[model samples]
Target: MARPNLTRPNATRPDAAGPNAAGPNVHRVQPGASVQAAVDAAHPGDVVELAAGNYPGSVTIATDGVTLRGQGNRSVLVPDPADHSACAAAGNGLCVTGVADDRGMPVRPVSGAVVESLAVAGFAKNGIAAAVTDKLTVHQVASHDNGLQGISVEMSTRTVLTENEARDNGQAGIFVANWFDRKGGALETRGTQVAANRLTGNRIGLQLRRVRDLTATGNLASGNCGGIFVVGDDGVPRAGSLSIANNVVRANNRYCEPNPRLDSVQGTGILLTGTEDVVVSENLITDHSGTSPMSGGIVLYPSVVGAPNARAVVTDNILADNLPVDLADLDQRNGSSFMTNSCRTSQPAGHC
Candidate 1:
């Protein structure tokens, strides 16, 4: 498939030289300056550039075709005790949201926004939160030590999250959902891509909840309670039609206590629950060992709401040393198949 030509806002690095160094479209903010002020003053095609220093406040981007960039990891955003912005009040380090309806669904998505090359930490909620956005690109950022997801996107389409680092977040390193506050059927993401990222030490590395038409590829996940999770429930248009490929998942044995919604998570590499028409292929999974019911290399299990997975294809993967088994298809209602996988053991045997 041909790659789509994603729209990008005008951007300039903080250290660039020559005529484009500080163009008229660039809004530069120093350490103590207000990033929100610069963002508010920017036009649709403008770039809001942050200098290499600590910025102590949350920032919200509602304008279209804007880019918020920083000087690599040296540009840091932390929570501010005195800030009263809606994003700060929501405990998010950075937020991009469009106009919403009465039901809190976006009527018009924020379009063509890019966020890159910064570090966001120590927030009470998600580090980077994007809701109802279209064609958003998040690249080369470091998000860690947040109370919730490191980077989260909900009800977004054509979003690209690539080459970022998410570590030690309280929840999933990267989370994508149809809706965070309500229970509903899967929403099509229109080719959202999560690729080439590094995820470690979070409760879950990457989680896809009630969403479809997305791809997670070329990622590395380890030291999390679970490497990757594709979850659905009893809702209509259930989560499926996605691809998980070319990922390196290893030793996701970090123990996490059971939450109200599910059991304890540990030693889970790739888990698919209540999903259908999903493809799991070309992954390297190893060394995930635990006694948890979800532990394994590649697992197909029933959802929390007792919906069984169907029509899942697990093929051409390499797996080793996973506890209980390398492949476990515990779903009773079966349309799932495991073929041509290189593994030692399986739950019902002969899958390898």
Candidate 2:
């Protein structure tokens, strides 16, 4: 689908230059100018462009229907020294969030926002985050070496993370979670897309904690702790109407956080912890060369997390099965189906 070019506003055709091409609604920030100030100054349908420089402090975007465009990697934001004593300030580099009321409930939602062409790194939490927002788009951004997820959508619906590069983050590169710990309610993600992204050297490439209508496609993941983690074990419902298709996942379990509970380090091409009704199809799952039985082409951790993952379809995948097991449905959760899979070893011929 063709998105409206925020640069032209009324123009039906998308302009290649976007808001950077210069217009009345475009605000340019110099090296030391505060990005948050520019966002505060911008109105709806406005764009704030950051010039190339190292900025300090978290940039809060309380505005709605705005675009924050950085000058590629040249625009960097470090942790706010005031917020923390050290570099890890525990705040998002660029935060698109709404205001809260007296009871700490969100009274407003910062919707229809876009953060593009920024190299977001360092300073505590996610490189870019949207909390309780809707229709947010993150495009052509390079987020790496952050404290947490490179890009995070927490309690946000209708979000898109596209053409982004996430690497060397402390946590998952791209994370879509309900933030139930903070919000505490029944969660249902609707209309979320994670496409054409490259995630590497992170704890997990793409971690989907809980989502209903989720689509993750045409992404590349490698040399991470894991790849394509479909998790919803704690208290969230199993993910339904989800699709993880046409992705390249390999060389995971490369870095394992030492934990006493698990005796071995484990990772997989696709780790379906406690998700159901998910269609994992047309993915090239291969070369998961790790020692842990948990590390394989495809893994299903049943009964270990939430109500055992049931009613899933694993089909049309190329599995190298280099690890201990290619696909493990050992407990065989009810309605666990498999079909049309090609594997080098450790898989039955018949479809399950």
Candidate 3:
């Protein structure tokens, strides 16, 4: 086991140099200094303390076990619109990727990474993505106004995304997706915890896709197209389990035809597709605007072949005043089951 010392050797001084000390280095990286220069100079467990300014550059964290903090989320690591094209191929504004699988999938393991206290915004892609690395924790990060998702944890396990705020992204706020290159399977995103997030005004708030034994709790999602999208795949969603509890999802729109030339999504509050062993409880879902002729507050549909029985236990929820269509539309073969709850307009009386 590694030593449990919180202080890294080179972290003590910004200019102290040696083998035992890369020198307590406080590099004030301006337009000329590369972001990779700061990262290369940092030793393991060191702190890359960014100044209070807009860094119009890209940063890739290659070292393990380091802390990159800033004066505040608002002033540090501001995305430059000019660099938007730089991230078009990578899929994230701040990309930290690892190895990929034979089926063109990123393989993530749980250990040795932490991204905290950075406010990343205004790129042409997802805000921050950590792929194929684990034991990772992203906290106090604000990601907004990106081309795609605010934050994406693709093929990652044992990750904790907490206290993050995602808003006005082109796609979902937080996405946990797996590559679908191989026919047999994509690896599971197990033991992942997404808690205490404030997601608003995005296409989809939180999408837990193809991950088993995942938990999304204590989050607030509002004014998005959909609040939470839990998906299961033909090969993976059958055995996966998603736990969505203690969230406040409200004012979302299902089948939203924002303009006359756009397509529509199916469900508004929670769209469960091709997954099993899901439990959505203790949530407050209200005021969803549905437009499609076949839309619902909560829709559970399966899209796999020859899979086991998919099950979703939805209880103790306050789903009220959702309209333009049905409240719940379930169309899978013996679809996701729901027990004693309230989809009524009123809470105690269960009026719809």
> What's the count of clashing pairs in each model shown?
0, 0, 13
Inter-residue clash pairs, candidate 2 = none
User: TM-score for every candidate vs. truth?
Assistant: 0.93, 0.86, 0.81
- Arrange candidates, best TM-score first: 1, 2, 3
Q: Which ranges in model 3 have alpha carbons more than 4 Å from their true place?
A: 1-33, 79-91, 105-110, 180-186, 237-239, 254-263, 304-309, 324-327, 345-352
Task: Report the lDDT tens digits of candidate 1 across residue range 1-352.
Answer: 1222224323434332222323436777899988998888776667788999999999999988778889989999999999999999999999999877877677999999999999999999999999999999999999999999999999899999999999999999999998777888898999999999999999999999999999999999999999999999889899999999999999999999988766889999999998989999999999998878999999998899899999999999999999978999998456788899999999888889
Model 2, which residues run further than 4 Å from truth?
1-24, 83-89, 99-107, 180-186, 234-236, 258-265, 303-306, 347-352
lDDT for residue 115 in candidate 2, whole number 0-100: 86
Q: Tens digits of per-residue lDDT for model 2 on 253-342? A: 685764432224455788776677888999988778676656778776652443567688889988874577677665465687888878
Query: How well is each residue in 136-222 modelled by candidate 3, as lDDT tens digits?
Result: 778888889988889888777778889999999988899876742234353466678899999987888997766777789999988
TM-score: which candidate is best? 1
Q: Which lDDT value does model 3 have at 185?
A: 51
Q: Which model, 1 or 3, shows the larger TM-score?
A: 1
